[model samples]
Target: MTPAPSLAELEADCWQQLATALEQKQNRTESHGFQTMTVATCTHLGADARTVVLRQVDADRKYVWFHTDARAEKVIQLEAFPNAVLLLWDPAQQIQLRLTIEPRLHTDDHVADDHWQKLWVGGRKQYLSAHTPGSVQPAPYPGFPPELGENLPSPEESEAGRPNFAVIECRVLAVDYLRLSRAGQTRARFEYEPNERFNWLAP
Candidate 1:
């Protein structure tokens, strides 16, 4: 990694990349490279990571959101230690963003409800699956409720998992953004602590 740019430049670049990534709904694919990040959580045993979708991002780019099953192991890990890392990479952009944050769970309230309401029927169907997340099954499982029966479940069925559904709110403490291009590679970092500052780095 080479020396990074001053904090101001880093921050500006981060904002630009983040905004651009969000604005483009389709860039040769359905999801933005930032949407699915490798969520790293600390457990008593060690660190664990899994890919999760990017549910929402604040205007300031300081906050990001993801949804998960309440029964998931990561939920338990977050409760123990809220600090986590979201690692995002875009093969198309040849860029990677590493966000270190403190995660807060949205249990029940307007925040969770609004996100739930925004979900499409197909998305809502995920919660209707009867099988518990991470549970052992005798046969191959698709991670959904058995016997979906011709139509999506009523609001009640979807709501059944509402309690089990959880939203992960990440308040970014730092973002390390790296970009690779033909015009040489560039890397930078922006930190929220010790005052907001951006620093350039060697690719």
Candidate 2:
């Protein structure tokens, strides 16, 4: 058996997995569990949560980001309450990461521009929707023009979605990491906000 990793090694593993996901080095399903994440936001009535694709990660800054429509309900919720939780689970690893984060919206800035340039036509198609996200529709909507069903949009045509494209960047304040096992579950917390700290937690 291998020796148990030091606290620092465990933390580095977490960041490495995130970075690998951004690099797309692994197949989507086989990605180290961060290809997608669940974002929970506060609303007037209660809490709201939805799944979003993970777009980018910066281990140095401890930041991760994803894109959404400018008119998304979650965006509106984040505008009101910038604090949220991001949840990720890797079934293969039997591990979970719960991140407390402060989210910021970037609609028109170098950050947004850079991310926009990275998106391919297919990824940009949803932003071309005529209606806002979560809006009720008379009939089912493709989230884009009907004519473009199951078809990739042209680069020029996709450029029109730029105005609706928005990026949500999360400054992860703390990470609660858990690895489930029959022998024993391992858990730890890594905090970065008020001060950087790391410690094992009761699993």
Candidate 3:
């Protein structure tokens, strides 16, 4: 069997996996464990966590982003507390990544436009919601208008949702990587901001 990779090599592997996740998301083919991540944000009451699909990733810049409704509660929380934690687990590989990040919102901007333009009709359907997310309703809501049921909007129709689309871009400051194995577990920390530092940690 091959020997375990050194701390440096492990760090490189972590970044590579992040890049791969984005690629997989684009392909829309094979399933990827890293496709979704739990975003934890601070709220006045306490902490709020939600699962967001991994949207865009820039390994060189150490950033990842996902789309959301502009009216979503999480947007309010992130606006108040820009710092958040991104937790990703790859059940297939038994690896979990925790990233400390600084999030920036992009709406009515070039960044949001780019992502919205690239989004497919089915994905845009959610953005076409007539009501704000998490709003209490007299009856159950299907997110989008009932008329659009089981139907994908035309490209032109999809554009109407642009006003509600918002992108949350997260800049990764530090990464905590953990891998579970039958033999043993490996954990490490990689800090990119303030100063670059890497160290192995006890699992």
By lDDT, who's the top model here? 3
Model 3 residue 163 lDDT?
A: 96
Please give the distance, in angstroms, between residue 41's alpha carbon in candidate 1 and its true position after superposition. Answer: 1.2
What lDDT, from 0 to 1, does candidate 2 have?
A: 0.91
> Can you write out model 3's per-residue Cα lDDT over 1-203, one digit (the tens) per residue?
99989878998898899888878878877777889999999999999999999998888888899889999999999999889999999999999999999999999899999999889999999989989999999999999988998999999999889999999999999999999999999999999999999999999
Query: In candidate 2, which residue pairs clash?
Result: none
Candidate 1 lDDT over residue span 143-198, tens digit each = 66767756687766676667667788889998887888897887877888658876
- Tell me the tens digit of each residue's lDDT in model 2 across 41-98: 9999999999998888888899999889999999999999889999999888898999
- The estimated TM-scores of all candidates read 0.84, 0.96, 0.97
lDDT over C-alpha atoms for residue 35 of model 2: 82
> Which regions of candidate 1 fall more than 4 Å away from where they truly are?
1-10, 23-31, 149-151, 154-156
Which should have the higher TM-score, number 1 or number 2? 2
Cα error, residue 99 of model 1, in Å, equals 0.4
Positional deviation of residue 41's Cα in model 2 after best superposition, in angstroms: 0.7
Q: If both were scored by TM-score, which would come out higher, candidate 1 or candidate 3?
A: 3
